[model samples]
Target chain A: MTSTDTTTAGKETSKPTPQMEGTTKEFYDFCQKKELRFQCCSNCKQWRHVPRLMCAECGSWEWQWLRSSGRGKVFTWTVVERPMHPDFVEDVPYAPVVIELEEGVRMVSWLSNCDPHEITRGMPVEVEFDAVSEQLTLPKFKRRNNPL
Target chain B: MSALQNEACIVGIGQTPFLRGTDDDCSSSLRVELQACEAAIKDAGLSNKDIDGILPFYGLSIAEDLAVNLGVRDLAYQATSHVGGAGPGASVANAANAVVAGLANYVIIPGGWYGYSGRRVRQIVVQDVNAMSGGKTARDFYFPFGLTAPVQWFSFIARLHMMEFGTKPEHLGAVAVAQRKHAQLNPNALLRDKPLDMAGYLASPMISDPYRMFDCSLEADGGCAFVVTTKERARDLAQTPINILGIAQGQPFPADDILTREDPFHLGVTDAAPRAFGMAGIEAKDVDFAEIYDPFTFQVIQQLEEIGFCERGSGGDFVADGGIELGGKLPVNTHGGLLSEAHVLGMNHYIEAVQQLRGNAGERQVKDAEIGIVTGFGDFGDGAIAVLGR
Candidate 1:
């Protein structure tokens, strides 16, 4: 034995168990093609975020889901040496990044594509969606053109 | 409330010495709670057993256990708010609401106990245990790595802010330095003197990433309490009475934290302060001093902008101009605050706010401060804000 405890535990989703609450089947289908989508509010003509059913601006229920530009900027990020949850133990000191897209929406995703030691404020990043499980794929981010 | 808006006030405050450890049992912590309760009662010149209701928020564990052990005679009402540290302001609001609704008069809102002093209690959080065992999160992401505490979680915020806003180590020290300087004048503070500079802060042992020992609030086993009554009774009881002007709480829109740019700098404050300000009917600039809850150093800067003390993103400059120090345009955390004084469940901020409003805060008192604002934020994105007036 190589002294490794267990490698093949046979699981689907990664830690944090990415489960969809308000996400739709259409959006899920769109994700299969590796495309990110946001909802466009009908009344205020603005894009809705976190994939909500109604418009935050006009409180309109009308929304049309469409593919995104897959681009954003780092707003704020933190190198989490401590796991907010215990399931994140395997990824011990992960970079839990907060990125603000130019389109004015903010999200929390992992930071990849650069040395965590080299990360700085306002670093530009792009979407890098990868399949973490058979039924689900997480949309994480990485530094633009800079792979560590 | 509309007719008597901005008229409610917090009249009294008190706390017990925050030690590093305690061998005390439930009844012992209850004794400390009673001590704080008595102090606030005396501070307000009221009777100890006069409280009609009890609001306990400092969950060394939870409410029922402490309430039962406290021997609170004639306890007509009881309540416990969510958001842990955010409970003080929330509890005060609960007390004020009880008074306003005539459910009972003279409610006692006491936030007590310790978060880390768990030797006697292993914290029987069945739900959290079940969730962790289900192999969903946290454990796989953090436990095996030993990222096991609240300070560690908050360190991530500081690291991210640095990566996004260029917030240097000095900015964190600037806040700590000011808080320590204030603590020097406060006899009740925990770490008086023991100065910390940017260099020293950078060298301090990392609790997690950017958070050093100094970057985090010094939490000792402490207790604090306040008494809420009608504004008229407050005037008749003490020479100086602090009134509860407003109280507010709020939550974010709930986004996929992993998929969006969640601004930790602009936190629950933005959603919370508006309600307090609206209730108080005063703009943020009019306030002479703010006794905001500072569990972490970065929280102050985030709060200042969100509370409308300055424009958004200018909180750094607001601090740069000495707006938050002693004798500045607007003093903050005058009673050493949670940073230097003690992490006494954010109820101490209410104590300081009441003291400032009543002009009784000894050497750390703000000059002629008639209005004081205090806020509390903790545990999974929750917060509460309250306004007090003389």
Candidate 2:
């Protein structure tokens, strides 16, 4: 059955806001602009996440912050049957899926707008943003309705 | 054989009482660490002046203070590994290297913490717990999306393993039941008297999907330390010397990004265990028992398979039917492990191996257990394993 809560749905605020500073600030600003972007190595053209200053492959300090296609497949996932943060109590039994983005990069985000039971390995999904706070907007995913 | 093989041995094992709650008397983390080191030194029958090298996996690099206070003049080697929980085994590996290289004679690897007492246990709150503690970039990205706590990180593995290999929740429950049985025999185990069954594990409150309360490790305050010296020297000391037959450390490619791994089911130990067995001049079959680091039940299942003890995707079946129990094919974590005994960052695994090899393990002893293996996993896919024998 589809999860009943829509706390993380829509363009609205959620429980706790993430603190943004440094490289994290740069990443969140793009989300505030409603653009999902991550680092791409200019030298090796390798996609990386948790944004790093240097490429592990080419050891190049050169990089570009490229916008994502906002599309990926679920590599693996876990439904948070018990919320770890009190702020997340309303969102109990939420699924945090690690999506393999089309650009060959992976990122952690919530899987929304579908039944938690419907989530499965290699399931196609697309990104949608929720402005959880004034300075913070989190990217979440829902099942892709149509193929690209 | 490698020059490091049989060159160094564990001379003593020491630890403070493991506690489920904070100790009013030993309140500070430093005090617990110091007392553990003191106990180790006392057990070794050596003065502080005798420790020439120190490997500290925890604390604020207090080895210098310990060396000076022990009234030591020359400190030849001092080092630490960045991998937190995965450190103890590698630390012992480093100590063995230092001893064999003549960089130091007596190397001590010390670890302990006041997790329960210090109120550092994971709570239902999303705060700066990640960035402030380790300050890694991964935390900044993952923590914001509610992927907090070690339990969540591990649940990712459990779910994937289930999806790929058809591993059931009962497969994971088997590990918890077997380890609790071992804990019952260990009077030092925090959950010693507590009993668990598959039905109880399945019904236990879910902390994270695919992980119930019994699947997770306990938050306990305790400390454990061990002394590493030359095998030749350890023979003259207080107890039977547990020789360091082989040791190795490994990391998955791009080690930190668990999501980016080529195979989600494999961890650092996949690469580490083979080299350790090779260096020990033995195979996985030669291991009489194992002291696997189990912060979660699924971890033990994964490690048992990945360590070459069984084929991949078969750890579930391997651990079934008491396969890892006291009389099973492999009697693992004979001292209850982090799952039920205490989480001393896997140092307790080493301590138990030393005890078993020395014939000092009373009720939980594996018969004729001459060779054993201990593994550590932490820092997002980094793993280490060491093989010890009498």
Q: What is the lDDT of residue A105 in candidate 1?
A: 68
TM-score value, chain A, candidate 2: 0.85
The stretch of ten residues in a row with the least summed lDDT in candidate 1 chain B is: B118-127
Where is model 1 more than 4 Å wrong at Cα?
A: A1-75, A81-93, A99-113, A120-148, B26-35, B42-49, B58-73, B119-167, B206-209, B235-239, B255-265
Alpha carbon lDDT of each predicted model: 0.66, 0.81
Proportion of native contacts found in each model?
0.27, 0.65
Which digits, one per residue and each the tens of the lDDT, describe model 1 over residues B1-390?
354465556667788887767776643356667678777777777775667778876444344544455545667777876556677878877887887787767787876665336322112221143212212222222222233345554566666555555667777776777787788888888777576555776787655567667777776677888888777666777646676777888654341122233455555667878888888888887788988788777777767877888875556667654568888867888877888888777878887787777677788888888888888876534678887787
Q: Note the DockQ of each predicted structure.
A: 0.19, 0.43
DockQ of predicted candidate 2 = 0.43
TM-score of chain B of 2: 0.95
Clashing pairs in 2: A84-B124, A85-B124, B22-B117
lDDT of each residue in A8-116, candidate 2, tens digit only: 4354434444446766778889998989999999999988887778998899999888999999999888888887765567777787789999998888898878776
Q: Tell me the lDDT of model 1 at A4.
A: 20
lDDT score, candidate 2, position B139: 49
